[model samples]
Target: MTVTAAAHDGGIPAPAPGTAPQQVTMSGAINRALRDAMTADTDVVVFGEDVGTLGGVFRVTDGIARDFGPDRCFDTPLAEAGIVGFAVGMAMAGFRPVIEMQFDAFAFPAFEQIASHVAKMRNRTQGRVNLPIVIRIPFAGGIGGVEHHCDSSEAYYAHTPGLKVVTPATVEDAYTLLREAINDPDPVIFMEPKRLYWSKGSLPEDASPDAQIASSFGRAAVRREGIDVTLVAYGPSVDVAMQAASAAMGSGWSVEVVDLRTLVPFDDQTVVASVRKTGRCVVVHEAQGFAGVGAEIAARVQERAFHSLHAPVLRVAGLDIPYPPPKLEHLHLPGVERVLDAIARLQWDDQADALHLPESSPACDSPASDSKGGAA
Candidate 1:
């Protein structure tokens, strides 16, 4: 499947409430988040391929082994399925196991374990069994890695009924969300954007007691508010959406950005609310467009906000082609320019063209109307 970007119009949505400062690199925040969670709960155990001795390929698990001891922080065999299956078994026995899949593509082998076993155990047992396993997989392309090393396969897990899929774009979220996922009494596929591992933002010293981790579990977070259109994205694409929104500001096109942190049990209320306010919605991801999470999100918006929509839901995604080589990485990945182009398409007015309207027509009559139109 190929990832695609869509466009829409109307007004911007309101930003989410702030719980912590955002100013740490994505990797640094995740490291700290995991450390905090482990420290708070002795039951929390972290293990996976090379995660213990190597501190993980991206260093997200650096120093964890030293701090937590080999029993709590260790490495396992290279088998993805074994890693996940063991995690499920451990969770069933009362330990919170956080397993790390080295890359996005590496997760496929464990699909059966996750989709059929980990995700359904609770339901099958009539809530008697809880699989509190957090599978962390470094995903997405952009660092010029070879195939299987940089694929965005979150859609697969998101499509599963009982799994919760989440990706953190900012450092604050990286720290907080991981803790939340670890604590939740279910299986969560934590997709970490490999390229954004070095991206920085500030994080809280401790998890927010009242922070809405569950709130974003299946819902979207509004990053920026504008009236012209809504740019929906997660993980790596979220940064692209923000950059596109900034560039659109000069063009007088206000773009609202929505970050769907969690894919499964997706927060349709947040997405629907934003789309209703903006009337146009565009979903973006690094995964192939075919049957991806973007399609699911677009379908939900169409169902809940059909009347409020000004244009059909669109998707901006990667090509269905296999992950290309390093040289072709740029073309394979979506960026700000592409997102802005999508917004322009959604805001296009053919009638204005016949009347000799300029190609760069104003997005809205006034800035106040566009800005204030967002949901609070």
Candidate 2:
């Protein structure tokens, strides 16, 4: 497969006000990455529903069109299939076209194109063409919009062969992953957690030039280190996992959070290492617990870390039912309580310190009913 990556000028990376990393929101980092990629490569084009004028439903594309011009970054008809179908042709013609799915569920209309053409064109053509396309999807529950807006449908894409599925759980990864996805020789489903779009983090000013989690087409990140349990997650669940870990700390339990940045390549190495060290694992996600991404992770851990595991790998995930309305979402989506509950069930070596949770903990709810948009 033939491919080319964007070149960044060599310079000292900067952090925040002090020696700390620069504070950035996930959405802001993605916008920055888009601008950087488009600036570095004229062949890069971005377009989707309301992505140009409305700056996207979340304003992630706010100033892109204005700064890059209509031709480079513009809006498109309210047609998901046409958008992706056209991109397939563009990529074959040697143009890098980045697409915004607006919402996770909204991408359904283009499923045929994605699963059939966009995904297989590279191998189907016997390496004659490379679909270096990045399909950006803002997914998962918490935004509290209507149905078809909060679905964690990553499995559908991840299940499809020839397609690379990835989700970034941190601000820095959001930036770096998108840039990497756009440069990939194959089609990439870049799923961004809509709930975490406003989540805050920092970009270290001193960042590596050659370092990113794309060398293996995927990489799991260790958000926190602990010896007791490994809490594995991706996308919005990363935030929930971190919250659970923080809460577990108060209960005298040490918890490690593993962010599976790229789901398709399945970063088994990092996750297995963490599970082996902790001897316990709990996979979390907004997707249904049955046959969801968590199931695959739990199974893999069981096979690879069988000797090291002290308890069966548990999973904290959404109910198998369809995405619920905004009011009932809390009862369905995976949350800090669910994660902690799963951890509590794990058989631990030291039962000395019980998980006596505080009577009241902070609520980790997403902007539910009040959130705008209808695609999950």
Candidate 3:
């Protein structure tokens, strides 16, 4: 993601309802969310490597230490496991601790603490101990980061039954979802797309944070509406899917973009409804396609809307390999061209022929494939 503005209003509170829309960067939105959460609840404390004094590696916590003091927003050692373990202890002791992992891969060392204690404490103790902890990890590739800096590690967290995994694509969601996650009673894995830290967008001054954390989990947001195909994505890939949807129009295709804002409580209703209407679906992400969130989504769509599908559910994802060097990442990450090519392979003619549908069928009617159209 490219930075539209170099600076962020890190300590500004969310605009009151009915206020004018304000331009906000994703990182700035997150910072404001932290400040607001701390102000609202004395129990909320944030700690991570360099999060206090240095204001975080990305400055998402820029003014937090000054606004809330070192007790509320403080720093910790480089021990990832220790940080998370300390958060677990804080949560158990009646505090809403929002701890940061600093980077995507850095969270790996704390998986034992996260998966075993943080995730299961509430259940293991028969609801007597509810760990309202938020493990924030800066994730995904795109910013030309080195080996440990970039990794789409949501799959590991999403696979855990006790954890709620979510990644915000837009600035509004970056603020709203973080606030909601802080208020939730269970543990949440908040994956921040590092690449999108500087991406800017506007939030209605009066708009309330809508990403529900406790009562209803979280719902998917449809970024774009279309009838030809549905492009499903989350986190950093949502922007890519939106871009693909825009480019698909050149080929006379109407594409819908579904942002699965919350992955753990996976919004099947929104995704299935879009797929049913469009009759074709493509799951996009920077994570490996094999056994990734895409595979799970494809399976669910096929199970729920199998008969409605005109073509097989497809995936536009990162290759099933280690994160590549910064120079070679472009080839590894899914781009608009790759997504368009996948869209082209929806078996238009085959679908039309297999169903023996009329020439008016969407598969046969697509203008991009009309040159080879209706060849039965």
List the global CA lDDT of all models.
0.79, 0.81, 0.85
Using TM-score, give the best candidate's number. 3
* Model 3 ranges off by over 4 Å: 1-10, 13-19, 207-216, 351-376
Model 2 agreement with the true structure over 219-289: per-residue lDDT tens digits:
78899999999999988898899989999987677999999888998888999999999998999999988
The TM-score, computed over Cα atoms with residue i paired to residue i, of candidate 2 is 0.85
Q: State which candidate has the highest lDDT.
A: 3
Q: Which regions of candidate 1 deviate over 4 angstroms?
A: 1-23, 205-215, 350-376
Q: What order do candidates take by lDDT, descending?
A: 3, 2, 1
Sort the candidates on TM-score, descending order. 3, 2, 1
Whole-model lDDT, candidate 1?
A: 0.79
**Model 2 lowest lDDT segment of ten:** 367-376
> Model 1 has how many clashing residue pairs?
33
Which stretches of candidate 2 lie above 4 Å from their native place?
Answer: 1-21, 204-216, 349-376
C-alpha-based local distance difference test score of model 3: 0.85
lDDT of 2: 0.81
